[model samples]
Target: MNFVHFATDIAHVSGFSALGLFIGLLLVFGIGRYIGVRWLLATESEHTSAGLLDGAIFGLLGLLIAFTFSGAISRFDDRKEMVITEANAIGTAYLRLDLLAVETQPALRALFRQYLDARLEIYQKLPDLKATEVALVRANALQGEIWSAAVKACEVTGSVPTTNLLLTALNEMFDIATQRTVVALEMHPPTIIYVMLFSLALISAGLAGYTTAGIAKHSLTHMVVFAAIIAITVYVILDIEYPRLGLIRVNSVDRVLVELRKSME
Candidate 1:
């Protein structure tokens, strides 16, 4: 698998990664403090000359955190919206199945039910990407079968109005499925941005430690709190990004589809 896929897999268990990051930050913080104390003793200086540089790095870190957190929220909202859209589209098409001849309705309705199940299963399978892929393939195949069945029924009904209304709905239903798949898989920011965020966070932690060198005693409380806050923020961002695999999720929004499926029965 590519790095993106690998990273996504890691994000599936974001809690562990966040914990690891927290530990690493604390270690780096201590190392930075040690180095700073040594340098202070050697130079016998009261203050460092890199205040401007420190400010710039911290500023950039804050900016990146804000942007990434904002973007994750936006994507999380979009995923929830997409779930509602798909549910609506599928419901519309299912109702329009009535436009077909009565004899054709049962078979098409059955296919619609199966198709919806496949769609739900795609995400419900979760961090098992292979199972999700299988579910997706099943869904795509069901889409083709649904379209073909709907077209055949329309031909039998011999009503242009019925064909237009029913086929249009089916087309929308199918289109939205593809669109939802794209959004779920490809809507994320580039991996490099996340890498940069992580790297900058570590560097800033080190600088923060260095700044405290002039203090007579190191503040363990401040160091721990700093690391914990950043680690938690990063975890939340990643959790929001991969809703299916993480604690922050859009699965609740999927109840719309579940209700629609029940209505079909």
Candidate 2:
């Protein structure tokens, strides 16, 4: 398998790994806090050095999260744009079918409808790589059917202009299909990047917790809030990165394709 497909195979694992890492970091930080308190009591070191270390690590974590989040958002927008572009390509191909002979138009239009149905199903089955494979196979078959019919029509009519227009539109539609597939597969950040983020988060959290160790009657609520926020932020980043995997998705953008199909009827 290619790198993209191989990475996709582990998509679910990576997603769940984020959660696991978050929880693991929380536990480590808690334990570190306890140890830190003891160390502080035993040695009575100045808080200034600890506080500086905490701020630096925490700043690094924040910067990493910001970069990851921005990349995810950009990819999300790209997926949305791909949907719109593909929809336009299909709609253009459907309209150009009118240039073909009446006899060929009906069969080609029917193929277009079937192709649309399959394309829509492909998105609906998202995050299910196997189901998507099935849908894509069906869509590719329909595309072949449409192409064959268009070629024969060109041969029969010997009309260069009309044939060129139809073929060009169909070619674009197919190209967009391939582009969409690649974009979907490559949208995620590498697993290693996420692993690094998790590692840094753990270290930063541990230091923060350590800072709290020596203080008497400090609010535990702050730590809880901090951990929860980090967890939720990481979850959102994952959700946006893999739009098909979580509550966040590109399904809403399917409306453009849906409308194109409706107009065809």
Candidate 3:
């Protein structure tokens, strides 16, 4: 996960929602504190057993957190690469438009330009199903218009094989656009993972605080550092999941868009 994108977005949105995710984390810590206090009261047993147990819990949680963190980062990178790949596909399709026909070339290029603009808009404003439904109606309408132009070109060319190439490019463009939508807008942290991680974080902290109680004055360092670690890691996960919504988003078209548009000329 792109820590920068996820953290900033969560900080802004969650902050506005009365600290949505953070408040929840805070609550978890609170519960852990309560549990630690209760457990300590119940067992004042300072056997080396307590320290060993604490060490084990910390080690396990640390390992799990590290593994999961790595997984999230890997997914984020995959999403980024997907964006670049999709952009390349669209750009390649657009350039292939030149292979159509003389009369069809300029008009086909115009249609591609419009499609790129529409696609960029979609990337910038994530499509809610409702809004997307409306936008898709418009997109379908635009697609019809574009295809009509392609049909005109094919008719002028009078060679099915040559025209087939243009049609194939159009199909490629569609696939790339659809792929972009998934990687850029919908790729997100799974809710189940979030729930599990959150639960684990609370459990870890409670155990850590409880174990270090008498031997340490519940050092502010550990709690603060843990919060920072979990929060930062989570923030990165979120950023990666939401590409278009943050600074770290994989560019929808990147250089490909400009290059393709230039090729049209």
Write down the lDDT of every candidate, Cα atoms only: 0.84, 0.81, 0.61
* Model 2 lDDT per residue over 46-89, tens place: 56666676788888899999999999899889989999999999
Candidate 3 lDDT (Cα, whole model)?
A: 0.61
For all predictions, the C-alpha RMSD in Å is 2.7, 2.6, 5.3
Higher-lDDT candidate of 2 and 3 = 2
**Model 1 Cα lDDT, one tens digit per residue, 1-265:** 2432553576666788789889988988888888888885444243544767889999999999999999989988888888999899888888888877899999999998999999999878766777777888899999899989989999999999999998888888888887777646578889899899889889988988887887898889999999999999999998888777776667888899999999989
TM per candidate comes to: 0.90, 0.90, 0.74
Instruction: Please list all clashing residue pairs in model 1, or write none if there are none.
Output: none
What is the C-alpha lDDT profile of model 3 across 1-265, one tens digit per residue? 2433343455356323323445555556656666666666444466467767877776766776676667767876776676566567667766666667766687777777777666655544442334444444555566778778877878888888867877777777676666555434445556676666666666666665555544535566666666666666666655554544544565643555555556656
- Judge candidate 1 at residue 265 and give its lDDT: 90
lDDT of 1 at 130: 77
Instruction: Work out candidate 1's RMSD over C-alphas.
Output: 2.7
Clashes of each: 0, 0, 4
Question: 142 in model 1: Cα distance from truth in Å?
Answer: 1.1
